[model samples]
Target: MEVPPSPTFPRALPSRSIPLAILSFLLVGVISLVILPHDFRLQEMFPSSCTNGAAASTSGQLADAATQPVVDLRVFLGVLTRPGMYERRAHLRLAYSLQPRPVRAVIDVRYVFCNLDKEEDRVLVAMEIIAHGDIVVLNCTENMDGGKTYECSPTSPTTTSARPTTDTYYRLAALADTLRDKPRDGLYHGFLNPCHQSRETQYMSGMGYIVSWDIAAWISAREELRHERGYEDSLFGWWMRKGGFKNVYGEEPRMYDYLDREMGEGVTCFRHELIADTVAVHKLKDRLKWARTLNFFNVTQGLKPSKMYDVDRLNSNMYHV
Candidate 1:
């Protein structure tokens, strides 16, 4: 059979219609920009599963935390623990680890560690785990790198006081506020690179960095995030600063090495801002040091500034677990 000829038009679009087509494309782009947000809010970053405490049926409080109103932030504190430091954990729980967090969705402090080599230690650790339900055994490494992955939970939480405004918290807020009021649309919607001049100037302090469960989830999901040069703080700071959450970092300074003794201030820090807005206190090893710290805060021994109580840490360091 013979083939039929088909009608054909010019290959190129008419020049007269070109301007209209371009205008339509530009219009669509503009409309899209106007409708979609620049970035997802920090509060809205977590998955629905994070808020669903069905996985925490054994925990009544956890279930409540899940059903509660939208949380501004949920902080998960990872306290490194090991075999014979059960007393330390007890001191912490009695001192301040058990305080209720204020104005937040959730605040859970977990005693994180790995499996023990000895059968006896393992047995003790297992008892601690079953008794507290606050223990997290990674079984992967003795290092805390794996713990960076934890972000949410329910029940007999790490149970620390509310989010202690560490330098990071203050910095996050300042950066956030700056981005919100910036003249430009913002580099990352709500982030402005405060350290654009020197990348070295930007970093988060790992000692006491408070982050939303959503942000934690995001960081944990990325498997490639690992330590280099064996400095977890430097790497963590770098990861967070460049996590696209903010261009610069903030320091919530209450995360002191020790309230007073660690900094050589010797009871002086108790009167400083570090005490008032305090969140996390690090470097307190041994039963004595922990006891002193607990006394210093509880004002069981010496004089405190706010008339809250008299706290002479040197004199009041008698209690222990």
Candidate 2:
């Protein structure tokens, strides 16, 4: 029932050489991410080397993806929004924030926003900031790209020699940060596209990506790594290859891109493609689309209506409820 390792993953790199004893234990789970909170000290929390990158595979227990334990995933869900998109922001807080946590993972939601140009708007934003302590307002102008700054929020690994910078990634109190203490024995970094790239060594959807605490720490802590790659996910991948770290890419189908469309073989349904426990979905630009997606997962498990009709009860039900 083992998921065959990606061609790039099975062979060990000289830079990332591991003792076979350790390697044997490392190959347990599929693609996953484990990030810790700022309040917890990294070394003290996860003192073992296994958490650095190598982790025992959680998927090996079952041959099929459906039967596997919902591996413990702690995600710092950072939703980026602009000033005028108040409705979109509200929908995120209401739907995504309210999403019932999966039995296998823990997810925390936070919105990353930039300063508003209109001075009059501050009054309204201030109220929102007060109501929900989740908003992170950067000093820079509000724009789509400002979300990139959230990458700066993670605490870096003390083991790395990456240089530090004056940027406020450390000073921001980490409201912009995602995920908290991952499994102590292993690393679980998340990414929407857990697949091999064509021209690029790593191809990841900026929307969602996962990594062990060490990888995120390496990127967030080091000031020099800030501008290394074009996108946040790519930058992390660049460092992985450059740093001689192993890439434990998981199954790509786990993260769906087709929101309401049919894909792959003969599956048919509006959001049937988005089955239960999809790690992440990308390119959700509109508020309504987000609502629909959330409703699909929460309200309608899939388009299939069975004889026993009550979706809440079904052998195929993937949800914990």
TM-score, predicted candidate 2 vs. hidden true structure: 0.54
TM-score of each: 0.51, 0.54
Q: In model 1, which regions exceed 4 Å deviation?
A: 1-58, 67-72, 97-101, 143-199, 213-218, 247-249, 259-274, 286-289, 299-321
Displacement of the residue 210 alpha carbon in candidate 2, Å: 1.2
Candidate 1, residues 1-321: lDDT per residue as tens digits?
A: 111232211122212211000000000000000001222222232112222222111133444655665533333334555555677666544443323234433444345444577788788877866665666554333432323222233211111111111111111222223223222210111111232334444333334433332334444455465323334444444544445433222333444445443455654322233344454455454555555555545434323456564445444546432
lDDT of each: 0.35, 0.38
lDDT (10s digit) by residue, model 2, range 114-230: 568877667777676565545545444432331233222323232111211111000011111222222222232344243444423543444344454555555445567544434
Candidate 2 off by > 4 Å: 1-34, 37-75, 104-106, 139-200, 229-232, 259-272, 300-321
Clashes of each: 13, 26
